[model samples]
Target: MKERNHTTLTEFILLGFGSGLGLKEGPFVVFLVIYMTTTLGNTTMVFLISANSPLHISMYFFLMNLSFLDLCYSSTIAPKAMMSFLAGSKSISFHGCATQLFFFGLFASTEAFILAAMAYDRYTAICNPLLYPITMSKQVCIQLLVGSYVCGGVNSMVQTVFTFTLCFCGSNEIDHFFCDIPPLLSLSCTNTDINVLVLFTLSSLIIVSTSMVILVSYACIISAILRIRSAEGRHRAFSTCTSHMMSVILFYGTLTFIYAQPSSLSAPAQSKMVSVFYTLVIPMLNPLIYSLRNKDVREALGRTISSVFLK
Candidate 1:
């Protein structure tokens, strides 16, 4: 048993880019731009999906929720991170850190499940088109969405309680931009074997399970596409899923690299770099990835612009 002084830690100093990472002004400006892009892009996605009647399907419903999640995801970490760089304000209250960790977990977990749900939607649409409406009915979609959020909330609640309850008698410095589980676990003075195990277990359960759903969904989707007799039909079917495939690959790849392994095997700089990708870059990229490959989105955007300008 490790001896801990049991002194209450009311706050933590975030050592985000504080150890001579780079000039503050440059990174601050870049992050500001990234945050703004994330906001605008995802907000536009949500609006376009919601306002356009043609886009009112299970796929677009999932996409709208995805955009909302990306917006929340980036907002959770980017604002504080940008502030840290520009304002030189690195200290965060204990409750504030907990809140941040909770929302970060909630949104990230929800997005993972939502991505799986989207994969499932694509699978049903392509693999079982005739049954798509019945299988992915409006009621079912709402249930899936609500279930994802609830599971996310539960995961965050458990993780937050586990993290904050750990004894922090030593340094209160968190070596990342936000209060993520890995960094916070490293800051604990008490024995963290349980915490680490819990983090890894819960993370694996959510990530691996959802990843399996995606993998299985895509596998079926591809098989069904291959069975199509016409080349044009095959292309059209596969095209609809490409955007989602890219999103899943980018999101799951980075997240797996970070959470799938224990922190001991990861260097702080390397970990932070990976974290920045999923937390900031990926959110900004998701809307672009979906829209650029999606004809419906392009046409809708053009129509919206034309309608507004020609009036």
Candidate 2:
């Protein structure tokens, strides 16, 4: 019996969804369209938020950050996967894989924090309407935004360093579309108990903490809305939160499913499907949901389009 060399791995072959599902061109077309839509949609969100003065408030400011995060997050995995699907080349250099892993974690974690901030903004706006302007002022919003990115960077650095430090003597074929911590940890030749523990701990802390913030904010918001005597006033107040709540549910639900459990408990195939939803579907849906459901965004979009076309 030959002992496996632990330090010889230089790259990893990502077994993309197409190969995993045994379909080539069909998945490629679907994913390509999804990628394009996500990119365009998120880009438009950023553009509209930045160019329109009416949307310069805290909610849209946080939304712009989210749009930027989604753009980077989807780019971290989607382009590589789409290229793999198109060119039938699934191999990624070790450094490239590590880079992807870092950015993916950074953007994802940052987005979670941003969502929490947005929830707090809503809470202030609805529950403490008189103080909303002071509570979510520009300086405070900037602080929160900066803090989210810093926390994300720290988290990414820790996870990337921990995951890549392990020796990969095992096969280099990752059973997913990207270089995720779980798939990479599964390939490690070293004992992965600490890595698994760290992954679980960090994931739980980020997801649970942010989710709690959102939950508490919404609880306060609901309470405040219930106090209103007029039904129309209550309905209008609740409507202001529906789009954000829907986004939070979709983003956090898929994320919790994918990251909240031990790697041993997750099936790679099922994980990939959930990953598809998280990475591709969510980003594409967020801007659409926010724009279609919110009257302000629609009016802004109409104004922006009219300005461009009329001139």
- Candidate 2 has a TM-score of 0.95
Q: lDDT for every model?
A: 0.89, 0.89
lDDT of 1 by residue, 1-311 (tens): 25553346788878786664344787688889999999999999999999899999999999999999999989999988887776645788999999999999999999999999999999999888899999999999999999999999999999999988888887888888888888888877777888878888888899899999999999999899889999999999999999999999999889888877676335888988889899999999999998999999998889898999999
For each candidate in turn, the TM-score is: 0.96, 0.95
lDDT of 1: 0.89
lDDT of 1 at 29: 88
Q: After the best TM-score superposition of candidate 1, give how far the Cα of residue 223 lies from its true spot, in angstroms.
A: 1.0
Give candidate 1 regions above 4 Å deviation. 1-7, 20-23
lDDT of 2 at 48: 95
Local error of candidate 1 at residue 181 (angstroms): 1.2
Model 1 residue 179 lDDT score = 86
Backbone collision count in every prediction? Answer: 0, 0
What is the lDDT for 67 in model 2?
A: 88
